[model samples]
Target: MKDLSYACSKFPAVSDPTADEVRRLRAEEKLSVRQIRARTGLGRNRVHELLRGVPPPEWTRRPNAKDGLRAEAVELRGQGCSVNDIAQRLGVANSTAYQWIRHLPLDADEETAARRRAHSKVMTDARWAAHRAARDEAQAATHRAAAGVVGALTERDLLLLGAAIYWCEGSKSKPWRRQDHVQFVNSDARLLGLFLRFLETCGVDRNMPTYRMSIHESADVAAAEQWWVHTLQLPATRFQRPTLKRHRPTIRYNTQEEYHGCLVIDVPRSRELYWRIEGLVAGLGAAIT
Candidate 1:
């Protein structure tokens, strides 16, 4: 390499003195990457490359965190133990054990058996299932705690929340054309339910929202229609003819059975409600800041 600076950057500046100092500490002092970075003003990447140029010491004679487990790992590998077995026995990570045993010699049968064990579907599936269970438990606990924090929403609280949701997801007026209508469209059943509750809090009549399903023509249109109908419990009279989106070659990932499409809830002649929602959203901004 021409210079450390040249290696690190596209265009080298006047040779950096700090790079030389890092090299001196790395070579002469035999300092580790962490120590070099802590003891010098040089960056981590700069320090890393400098140390990487030198061969690792034949033996890490110095005591380390892994010193207790290293001998056991080596012994296990010599006895034809797989990396996973060594890791489990030594209470070290699989990657850590692999790094220590990677250069060790393995007989043909031992290597083949290890590879087969590693690729076993039952073991892999069990590991993944356990990990997913733990993850789901932790996530559900967090959600429960968060839900407890928001014990209940009063009418005013619901009003503010609905306005914020409407501002974020509902249709709005543009500068070119003035269209003040309270129209909310979403694929999420939970969000639509919350919006419905918000509408009730705003003194909107229960039968006010006109429902329309916007879905792909190729989807189970009747099933989607039934799902929305069952979800809202609104009369068939309030339902508009479902707007079918033409199938396109570019469209992907939305052809699954669970893809019920989006429901558009419109309150015709809702100019006053739209303005009120806008004001509520503005008030929320003022209150938040």
Candidate 2:
């Protein structure tokens, strides 16, 4: 009623309003003194003083331990405490404790370093000797076992069995070779018996009618067939006539009488059994090798 604008002009323009206006605005608009300063563009300190109230600043200050503590942390690490023990005392992670310890001296006394070097060398040598002895024993045992088994079979049987094993398990298969049956090529009788026994152990029926044989042309083919016939109790019809390979002068032919021949064992759908045998062979290979 008495000129409110002129009365308000007594105070600074950018500063807060008078107490009467502040009370009137607080009652009318329901704003705190800090909220009033934000809406009216008034100086923070002047607004609070004019409204007869105090307001805290918007930003907060955080406290940190000074460098004095870090220096002490480093000193504690040099006194020979382990990283775990240090971390526990300092209330820090093990990695942080290790970081502090890494700054310490790496040097140790000559006697202490020499003892560590000697101990390490001795342990390494002992481990090597143990492994060497085990390897030699395994090799000797494998050779003896193979020799005993092969000795029981005739020389012809050995060659045939070896050839069959090589064809089936050996890495000699070519893409052009159409023959998919299990074949072995070797002159060693003991190896042949071993292969047969290995097959028998893999659930191949001893009385299965699918068993067959084939031999080389150079050797006594009839005798070879008869021997397998008597041994496996199969008919002569199961034996395939030998395939003769002619000799060449340039090709080094060490064809000994001992080179009995090769053999082919026929079984319909033998692939499944072949896979099972493969797994069995693989398990034994580590010990054999």
Candidate 1: the clashing residue pairs are: none
- Please provide, for model 2 over 1-289, each residue's C-alpha lDDT reduced to its tens digit, 9 standing for 90 to 100: 5778866768655733366576555566667667777777777776666656433333322245534545666777667565667778888888877776676642357786577669869998898998989999999999999888855656445444544465455433246964334544444455555665655655554454243344444557667666666655555665555666554445435456444455555555565554544554465566478
Q: Give lDDT per model, in order.
A: 0.84, 0.58
TM-score of 1: 0.57
TM-score of 2: 0.33
**Best of the candidates, lDDT:** 1
- 1-289, model 1: which lDDT tens digit per residue? 4657756587666876777787777667767777778898668887777666675443434678777788789888999788889989988899999999888965457778677767786788887998899999999999999889987889998898899888889999999989999999999987888889999988886588899999999999989988877876666678899999998888589788888899999998899999999899888889889
- Candidate 2 achieves a global lDDT of 0.58
Q: What is the lDDT of residue 138 in candidate 2?
A: 100
> Which portions of model 2 show Cα errors greater than 4 Å?
1-181, 206-218, 231-235, 249-259, 281-289
Determine which window of 10 residues in candidate 1 has minimal summed lDDT.
Answer: 53-62
